[model samples]
Target: MKNLTDMMKQARELQSKLAAAQEELEKLEIEGSSGGGLVRVTLTGKGAMTAVKIDPSLFNPDEAEILEDLITAAHNDAKTKAETVVGEKMKSLTGGLPLPPGLNLG
Candidate 1:
């Protein structure tokens, strides 16, 4: 049927776009900070951590736990941002089409 053919064509185009978007995401970088900017994390759009920074003052051995907590928080922030970026890109590629709940492209 013509409708089926058209749908297939659209799906193919969407797949292509999604592949390109994923590649772009791999190249993109996002930064997240916590602890009043004492700790920072950089992650690729795909949620891979590329780098982490911590203030020298936080290097105290006794305060290692606090540093660890800040790092985790910073990482989580970056990951959330990465997911948001992917979601926005997907929404744009889909032209605001409603996807099923929990239908993650990642």
Candidate 2:
């Protein structure tokens, strides 16, 4: 009974820490760029897009498709970075506890 009680306490503490970690993640921002820095995107650790930047040189109407591709690349880059940040934070929060495969946080 004592061991079970202690386990419950630890579970509650972990839950609290996980919630705090998620809140902290919302405050983090990561930047990613593509097309040799012609395009850039910023994303929060929670995977929300915060901003986008594009070089003025890529504004040609004839290159709309290229611009679109660059934007996609930059957004993907930002998303990947955000995921990595969240993963690292979760790892720290869980004390390296192994999460089941395919169970993404977001």
Candidate 3:
């Protein structure tokens, strides 16, 4: 009974920490770039896109496809970084507890 009580208390604390971590993630930002830095993307830790930048040289009517590809690559890079950040935060918050695989938090 004592062990159960202690475990419940820890669960409550972990839940609180998880909520705070999620809120903090929303406020954090990460940047990723591709195509030799000609394209850049910024995303919040929660995987929301905040901004995108492209070099003026890449803005050519004949290179629309190239531009589109670069933008997609940059966005993917930023999203990957955001996922890594969130994963690290969650790991810390959970004290490295092993969660079931494929259970995405977001």
Q: lDDT for each of the candidates?
A: 0.92, 0.89, 0.90
What's the lDDT for candidate 1? 0.92
What is the per-residue lDDT of model 3 for residues 1-106, given as tens digits with 9 covering 90 to 100? 9999999999999889888887898899999899999999999998889999999999899999999999899999999989988989888878899887896664
Best by lDDT: 1
* TM-score of predicted structure 2: 0.91
Residue 3 displacement in candidate 1 (angstroms) = 2.3
Tell me which of candidates 2 and 3 scores higher on lDDT.
3
Which candidate do you rate higher for lDDT, 1 or 2?
1
Question: Tens digits of per-residue lDDT for model 1 on 1-106?
Answer: 9999999999999999989988999899999989999999999988889999999989899999999999999999999998998889989999999888987775
Q: Cα miss at 88, model 3 (Å)?
A: 1.2
* TM-score ranking of the models: 3, 2, 1
For residues 27-52, could you state the per-residue lDDT of candidate 2 as single tens digits?
88899999999999998888888899
lDDT of 3 at 77: 93
